[model samples]
Target chain A: DAGITQSPRHKVTETGTPVTLRCHQTENHRYMYWYRQDPGHGLRLIHYSYGVKDTDKGEVSDGYSVSRSKTEDFLLTLESATSSQTSVYFCAIRDSGRGGELFFGEGSRLTVL
Target chain B: GQQVMQIPQYQHVQEGEDFTTYCNSSTTLSNIQWYKQRPGGHPVFLIQLVKSGEVKKQKRLTFQFGEAKKNSSLHITATQTTDVGTYFCAGGPTGAQKLVFGQGTRLTINP
Candidate 1:
């Protein structure tokens, strides 16, 4: 219960369409991360933001981009949806004081047809 | 890239039985953390172990960090039906805040 929220809990889009998922937090955390969970891959980071307008690519950044214009909001966008991109996406905020433990949102399940 | 591997991808146990899952990392870790995700729910932070050969317990759940700092284990004593879900171990490398998570072990409890 870290006061994190993810919009569009579920989505289904056609291939080649653009989709954006939003993550909003009220805890005023300094670090925000986007991750995707698949059957065998587990949770793979796509992007992370350390501060407003400061972001970095993660292990699985291909075909995905992120932006954080404010401390409370982080956005992840899929430029062109692909079948391989069909997975559950999670938004997390790092608890700097707690051994770098992350608090995750409810998650968004996206399906590409 | 650092990789954290978990064994026994799937586990089935009867209520009151004991269960354990292991996680291994290819590189040394500065700290390790455990998370649990209930069925159709998000991952929730459980505990963190920083020092080598550290052991911590939360009721029936016991978490341990290996002496080498590259392995970790989560053991549940007298498993309950509520323990049905996936358990993940994430490792934070030395001098970095980023964490690499293990694939996770999905536990199914037979009521």
Candidate 2:
């Protein structure tokens, strides 16, 4: 929780609706990632950004879109929410090393009806 | 598809017992990190292993990276009730920012 805060920590939305989750970090870390965890599936990456406006797809990016317009802000959008999209989403920032540890924000729990 | 697999999906032991979790990556990892997540809590960073055949210790926790650099392990000696949580291992591939995580090993201590 150090510098990472996720907005709308808990959400309930209807299927086919558009929803966006916001992640803001005060640490100004260059690497930010969005991961969704479901029961028994561990944490699957949805999207990640290495720099402003530089984003890439993760393992499960089919229904998720991410935008990083600023250093501290990363937004993940579900173009159209679905029941299967319901899960706990976490925002993480990487430490500066060849490949360092991640500091995670409190996760966002989303429920799609 | 890089696979990071963790062994002993669940571990239950008496207080003061030792515990260990193993993580193996299908591909060689640039580095590996271990995290501990309490029930209903986000993961907290525990340690990072960068060099092959490297071993580090923190209090009762010992972390090691295999000489092949494709596997790692976390061993806790004389565990306590406070150590109840899920232990996760994440691996980062060379030139990649994504830290793909293993399924995690949940540890339970019987007090």
Candidate 3:
């Protein structure tokens, strides 16, 4: 296990509400990524951070935003939740020393009603 | 945009049977990585193939990268209940910083 932790392991919120999921890591990795997993879609990248205050949008960035102010914390926010946004979100840290292998956290299951 | 496609959305096999999944990328990949996710669990790294036409094996599991660097495959021998899960292939495009994942192939084993 790679010292990664995701807050709010499970959440259920009504549509149109704002939600933020947090990912914290202790490995001091340089790369952190956020991914959402859905049936038939595998794991789709949402956003990623290469360093403090350095972030990039992923393929599925619509309706979602992210921030990383510190090396150990990454945050993903859903501006306005929707039913389509319901999925399991995973936070990962890239271990460049290990051929850039990604070690993921336990994951956060979010439900939008 | 780079895309990775996987075949057989779902597969069911009896214990001791063989199973295989294929992965194809729309663009040539600098590297291909495989991950396995058990039901209700997060994806875990399995292996990565960086060289073209590379083949690697892990016990009863075998992994291969195409000569063109645009495809890969994972083959499991003597499937067991422990192998039931979804297998995903992610492709890192040449000079790209992000990896694109395939839809994945879900495996179910009947003991």
Please report the candidate that would top DockQ against the real structure: 1
- Candidate 2 backbone overlaps, count: 0
* lDDT per residue as tens, model 3, B41-93: 88899999999899999999999999999999999999989999999999887
Better of 2 and 3 by DockQ: 2
Q: After superposition, how far is residue B47 of candidate 1 from its true place, in Å?
A: 0.3
Q: Relative to the true structure, how large is the alpha-carbon lDDT of every model?
A: 0.94, 0.93, 0.94
Select the stronger candidate by DockQ from 1 and 2: 1
Docking class of 1: high
- For each candidate, report what fraction of the true interface contacts it reproduces: 0.84, 0.90, 0.84
Determine which window of 10 residues in candidate 3 chain B has minimal summed lDDT: B91-100
Of the two candidates 2 and 3, the one with more favorable TM-score, higher being better, is 3
Question: Pairing residues by index, what is the TM-score of model 1?
Answer: 0.98
Global Cα lDDT for candidate 3: 0.94
Q: Scored by Cα lDDT, where does model 2 land?
A: 0.93
**Candidates, DockQ:** 0.89, 0.87, 0.87
**Structural similarity to truth (TM-score) of each candidate:** 0.98, 0.96, 0.98
Model 1 alpha-carbon drift over 4 Å, by segment: none
lDDT per residue as tens, model 1, A1-113: 89999999999999999999999999999899999999978899999999999999999999999999999999999999999999999999986866688999999999999
lDDT by residue (B36-107, candidate 2, tens digit) is 999999999998888999999999999999998999999999999999999999997877678889999999
* Model 2: docking quality category: high
lDDT of 3 by residue, A3-80 (tens): 999999999999999999999999999899999999889889999999999999999999999999999999999999
